[model samples]
Target: MNPDNREWERVDEKMILVMRLTGAGKSYFIQQLTGMNVSAGHELKVHILYLANFVAGTEKCQVIQTSIGNTDFAIMDTPGFDGTTRSDAEILKVITEQLSIIRLGYNLKGIVYLHRITDNRMGGSAMRSLDIFEKLVGEDALSNVVLATTMWGNVVDIAAANRRDSELREEYWGSMRRRGSTATRFDGTRESARAIVEQLLGKKAVVLKVQEELVDREMSLNQTAAGVLLELEVYAEAEQIRKRLEQLESELKYEKDSNKRLEVKRSQRRNAKAFSQCAEDKKTMKSKPGVEVKGKLKKWAESGGKIGLQALQGLAAIVSISFGIAGFILGAGF
Candidate 1:
């Protein structure tokens, strides 16, 4: 048999990942593609406190092997750690470790990002997850990413779905598409699911950026692209929040009315939450690997250098908010 045409069994399977937020049709999409019921897998990685300390093993990633047409695939389903059960830190750790193990054995093909077609709009948490995903995979490997949206059967408005798809292509998914990522839709049927796999069937399998960073470069969690970008965002947001807090404190000093001071105090408390989270973010990055960490984050996180954070955040807001607003304007009802 030709090496290229060989249908490797479980041990030598061509693997791809199917990633999405917790309920964004990841399970249904996989079943449609693989002809297997894989719902029983993907338990959360449990951490136990023993003797007043905590420990955990890598347990979040699940792989199932199935053949469709002439090719054999090991589909890796991820519980996209969107801070529901596990923190992003834990999620990143688990995914990197699992992929490292798989990299030694299988030909990791590409990433299948399953998004829901009926999302009303891309919610904030979903957007953040996608942002982290891009940082994990990097711009160089985007050609290996398939932005495959599912749950089309639930979407009643055909034109609306198309608009949403276009909106994603133009706005949310635009940069990835420009970098060679392909976007497609998956209806619920088995035929449709197989078709999704067919699209990536011929693409050459490649090592993901996460695998390269963690395995090849032997970089620590903070030194990795995803980790650095995450810390940068937290630091930037913290700096912004700190400015707001200072202004509020200054105003409180000048304000005379008791009611107004109380209002300022409430606002300060709310802003303090962001401060506490930022402090925790810094602490986690420093302490997780059991080393004293030091280094400034890169000036610009994207492929290019030094795009202002304000400009990036503004553009993201415009793109994200427009998805919901465009539905109404285009007569694509929610």
Candidate 2:
């Protein structure tokens, strides 16, 4: 039997995507919801490396079919945005591949984005994941998104947790909540998990931005809205690292102590390695070919050369790799 046929064996099942950073309790939530013995690791490295190991007798990005109160669901336990073993670009590629499969005939009822309440602050990785998620879903489908915070049981200070929760709604997740996306808590119980799933039970199936861009618009991964956002972030980080290297170079020259000078050299080496990785990530982003911009030079000429020097350089790179110029414009939105 073909794998695609096996996937759609039950056409009536409602599809849901459960996504978050690693160790945010996605697998545990699924285990609670479906009564499946999916492994939800407590250790950070274990969770990052193996959270998606066992689910519905399948591996990563596979659907776990289950039922709750007569409504059958095919829940997707997605890989985390920050995986120790996979780059963000690779993780996005895996997710898009699964989305492509889901688009074949399934209805993606909703998305559950999980966050750890124990986290003291919204770090760069978390913010990047959220940004990519927003671009992937687009503003039009915000109503179908549920921002869920988990790991309440592990929190020591209830007051602090409550304050953080408020901060999430008012500060971090403010825009998403105001735009029809809701905020909720998952208390690590079957009932709580069921309630979260039930919230999306009646929502109409949504066509995510990535789905439209990748499938309907025939855009490449690099040219998609989310992809462009990731690229811009990489470029920005690389630029920051470049500046840091220059600062470290100056510090190393002026340092009198041997120990301090060694530390500066170490910092320089680290920044250089990070900058090189960013460049490699950029290359990976533009590797896959998709819809090409017909008359690419003509479009660039018509833009009156006003897209800025940075955007023009980006356009040059895209044209060299046969990607569309739309990616640069998409970056402007961020």
Give the clash count for each candidate. Answer: 0, 0
Tens-place lDDT digits, model 2, residues 1-334 = 2223332222444678888998898878877776655666421121212222222322255355556766666676677778776567666766775564454346789899999999999999899889888898898889999999999999999999999999998998999989999899999998898899889878998878887776556667889889998777778898999999999999988999999998999888889988888888787677432223223423554654333212323333434421111110101111
Structural similarity to truth (TM-score) of each candidate: 0.64, 0.68
Scored by TM-score, the top model is 2
Cα-lDDT of candidate 2 = 0.69
Instruction: Give residue 205's lDDT in candidate 1 (0 to 100).
Output: 73
List where candidate 1 sits over 4 angstroms from the true fold: 1-11, 38-59, 233-334
What is the per-residue lDDT of model 1 for residues 70-118, given as tens digits with 9 covering 90 to 100?
5656566665766455456656655665465444345777888888888
**lDDT of all predictions:** 0.62, 0.69
Model 1 error, position 174 (Å): 1.5
* Residue 96 local lDDT, model 2: 71
